[model samples]
Target: MELLGLDSFNLVVRHGGFGAASRACGQPKATLSRRVRDLEESLGVRLIERGGRSLRLTDEGAVLHAQTASPVEAINDALNDIRAGLGRPSGRLRISAPILFANTALGVLAAKFIEAYPDVILEISTEDRFVDLAADDLDVVIRANPRPDDTLVGRCFMRNELVLVAPPGLSRPARVEGSAERLTFPAVMRMGTGDDDVWTIIDADDGLPRRYHPKAVLRLSSPLTIRNAVLAGAGAALVPRTVVAEDLASGQLISWGTASGPEIEVWVLHASRRLVSPKVTAFVNFVCDHFNAPTR
Candidate 1:
């Protein structure tokens, strides 16, 4: 249980400098330096390589850090699991997610989590851009098709299926075929990442994927704007199942095609650490359990 020293090392890597790490960790620079030195002496291998004013991890340090992070995080998760088993979740949980998901899904889950753990502080940020969880002081990031680094941890939270939806005024094409199916009205595209145009549908009977190419009319990264546009009678759109759930339930929008579509997996991600304290662990467990609930 080299918990304390491993945490300091992880902080130094996250902050990129001793001074910044000291400030973030609320420790004096001298004290942090001594702690790291003691850790190096205890391990008999240099963890941080001096790079003028900045510090870089030695090859051995990188491997050691990576190997130790998950266990540290698991320790933290274990503590939280114990606390949750006893019916108490008390800690701070920081989260970041896409604007659409943050507003629609996480908002509800966060509220429920806070209610369950009244002593826990749930900080959430809604940004479409990606943030480094370790560096940005973030505990978890919910992302679609998240590709975590070797030093990070990822947990799939939910599965997302993309579907084409349009306003009531849009006309249904007489013949819908393969990826080249031509629709009469222009399509509103969620222009995030480069794969917006590559719309796919899954064959319900065979459970195989089929692609579709729509006539592009509007291209924007904001899913909210696309939803609003579709609601205001712009055109058809390929959007997340969660994003359109309420509107579809309310009959504001309708599913466009018969074939099913591609599935985008959503994940909860966090930095790899040697020791996950009670706070971080509790949050991860709570989030996973919350999202994995029967209603979810």
Candidate 2:
């Protein structure tokens, strides 16, 4: 069987259809269809079952794809490595990130990375949902730990401290005499999938952890939304320090100290640590190094 035909078939499966594969590979749709058909004929078995507006792989096609996909990817990756070793990083790099990060430092870092490696085409997706790297054909993802999949490798590049904050004009009750007298205020919180309504706080003086079930005035999913609500004097919110640092500096928000919350550890995640492509490696290293460097 011709390797070219097999490669064409693989592209069709990867991109979901001949039209998509044609666009991705910069080939004509009819040409790609003919190549895949040639591959099926040479194997003496039907590979793909074409139906109304959808494509399905026959059993033979499934087996062939399962066998050939990895080898084809490895070969492409090897070529990319050679190109990269010759001095420039090139090729498409697909990344996934949360909306908050994508709107913040990630936007700046991505711009700098693209500027540094002009040949690399960067595609970024922003959402709150967890992405399956292999299934989604993603090269890298930036997210908070604990990672969803154990098979994936993650590099922790930054820590996001969670802090309780309120608007500068919001009134705070006078500090009472006892430990139990620590004030509880209405809070805007991110509603978890579970039914728990508890918030944790660390005692500023004794350094012990405390749990407070504050009355939730509003529950929302987005950190940026929660931050805005707090800034509007709706209620206090436990949020990542990065989200509110500018507000705190500008005196729009006041910090109520560290919250008893999970460490918002940020990680750069990928499917495999071994045999990573040059595009993925360059991006991961650039982000890690940028965050690791000491500030002025």
| Error of model 1, residue 147, in angstroms | 1.3
Displacement of the residue 289 alpha carbon in candidate 2, Å: 1.5
TM-score of each: 0.63, 0.84
- List the pairs of residues colliding in candidate 1: 69-273, 69-274, 72-274, 72-275, 72-276, 76-276, 201-261, 202-260, 202-261
Residue 180, model 2, lDDT = 68
Candidate 2 residue lDDT tens string, 1-296: 56888889989998888888999989999998898889888889988998748778999998888777655765676687686675357887889998988887887999899998888899999988977765566778899775467667758888888888888776654455566643667788887623345556675456756565556788999999999888888988888999999998998998766876567888888766345776777888888888993322
The candidate that achieves the highest TM-score relative to the unseen native structure: 2
In model 2, how large is the Cα lDDT of residue 177?
57
Clashes of 1: 9
- Global CA lDDT of candidate 1, please? 0.71
Candidate 1 lDDT, 1-296, residue by residue in tens: 25677877776776788899988879998877887778888989999987676777899888876666545545555677576764455556678888777777777787777776687788888887868764456667778887647766867767777777877667855545555553355778756434335555553335555555667678887877888888988788877777888898898998764345346887776767534555555666776787783333
